[model samples]
Target: MSGMGSKMLELDDEDELKDFRACFVDDRSGVNYLDGNSLGRLSRAARDSIMTAIDQEWGVELIRGWEHWGELSFAIGDTLAAELLGAASGQVVVADSTSVNLYKVIMAAHSLVPDRRVLLADLNDFPTDRYILEGIAKANRMELRFIATAMDEPVVADDFAPYLDDDVAVVVLSQVNYRSGALNDLAQIAYTVHSVGAMLVGDLSHSVGAVPIALDDDDIDFAVGCTYKYLNGGPGSPAFLYARRRLQAELTQPIWGWFSARDQFTMAPGYEPVAGIGRFLVGTPPVLQLRALEGALTVVCEAGIERLRAKSLRQTELAIELFEQVLAPHGFRLASPRLGPERGGHVSFEHPHAQELTSILLRDHRVLVDYRAPNRVRFAPSPLYTSFAQVYEGIMALAKAVES
Candidate 1:
């Protein structure tokens, strides 16, 4: 469609990750998928894993599967931590939805500082995160302070310095901005929050798997993230949370289900929470979905997170180049960070008719991208399976969509 397509083909031929495309189910015959930031494509490993979990684990083992199924949460979480998140083994656990985990962490943070009356957060965070924090603030009669951030720029640690005070109990921030694909400095923000006698809770939904995160090294008090997007854990897959080892003894979440009890099958009269990260669990684990995630994680582990991040940066660089050369002339402005490390895996553009343009791309050009409110179209080039050629074709189709 454009002369840049040949250059993309050359780049693809030289890519060490060219073979990774075969690892996932290639259902897009005539389409170019650019929405991995929203939901990743299904992988062949995940498909086989789900079938095995159902047919073999469930069908054959029956009740005995509980012996293994019960431990999948921590087991999978440990694997994620080792492979992706830079945290120790027992500090993380795969559990409820991101929203639910956020609720638990927010409540726990508030309990830690009962005297504090304010909870701070980013005004432009994901809607679900803001809703959970708002509910927590309303329930506890605490002041919810939102730090206003520029829509087109990234949120830096300096933005929160003025908002920090002794009255602030917790500061919640996303590692990567969902709308602009801007990466925030987690370590600096965490340090700033702790300086004010407040705890920091990070939302890693966009950054996990797309980039490297050192939760333990950063001294993050609490964190929560979904697996469906960058982790490629299928739709509605279980989320995970992290709590520092030192805080485990003091942190008590709102929900106290049997799974989080000291002895799950003891049926004790009083509830005694477990002493580790497992205490964050609320109820029964999703075995089928977890199996799918387990399988998906294998692919990520095999590919290695560092290598995947390198490819992600390169792919996004290509996308940005195309945006400047082609889409910029058509009234599209770069919404994501122009620099490589300052951005996440996705690239977003602000356009007047972004919503309509997204629909037209999908319906006519078979190029899939997601639209955010007002006017932003996001294109996530997942490193695990997305290719430079695909990125090239998607941008060409997007340019044609704008023209038509």
Candidate 2:
């Protein structure tokens, strides 16, 4: 092995989260998987939990399973709120997809300040988020504005200042940039948005389990995130929504399904929404997916988010170091923040041929990663399942792939 490879192995040996890697089912496909920011590895606990739910809960208990499963959404939400989001109970609920949750929260926030006619978001916001804003703006006859920012830079409070007028009702921003892996200052942006009486809606999809977030401390009004990425939840798992305790009473989501009905079981005569976070829920929760996430979260809660964040920072730092030393010579330029604290769980690089290179790395080099847009390749080192050695090998493989 090379000297650098030996150093990485040593770091892995001392890693505190080393034991947690065994909790996941490694396919042993010999691929250096660095796409955890896109989708996390499956955990053994999640598999067992799903099987148990299918055999015992569903087969044996059958329809009676509702007795225990009735409140599973809220129960799981509370766990996520406490462990992952740094939020209080009764403020968060697990339901719907990230896009759907964003719609609900953004619409609810807009209603709070109906007189305002403009909705604002980052110019490079995720495609789905931009689509949702466009739809909402057209339907409500409101103007939607974007805070323009370079692809490599994050949208900071300063960027939003010029657009924050009395007409701006809701300001939406992602806690972490999906493409650049840049971390935004949530507290500062929240303070800035609140200053103008505009509500701040945070999209936590890229930061949730991989980074430490204090929604309450930041005074963020509403937030949403997916569990399938850093949380190790299975594919198509429900996303979570957070509405501050103060906002729950006044806000109402567009969807008014039976699950959100005040008396869900009563088949109520009217469309009265339930009180608290339960009102955000639109339909019956996906029991099996929720179970998978619940089971997977046990590992995260046990390891703790602070610890996870520390390891994530170190791993990403290592990746950046390797990139500077090797990949830069091969035409890769750092697209993410150079400072670890300003970055999320991953590091991204820009190359003219990033898309084609990504395909070669996956098909030929067995280095799994994802490519974005015009030119970005993201390498996500999940602290729980990804080791320092994997991060080292993944970048090294990318360097070799470029050479060949």
List the pairs of residues colliding in candidate 1. Answer: none
Ten-residue region with minimum lDDT total, candidate 1: 1-10
For model 1, the stretches where C-alpha displacement exceeds 4 angstroms are 1-3
lDDT of each: 0.90, 0.90
Candidate 2 lDDT over 189-241, as tens digits, reads 99999999999999999999988999999999999999999998989999999
Clashing pairs in 2: none
**Candidate 1 overall Cα lDDT vs. reference?**
0.90
TM-score of candidate 2 on Cα atoms, chains taken together: 0.98
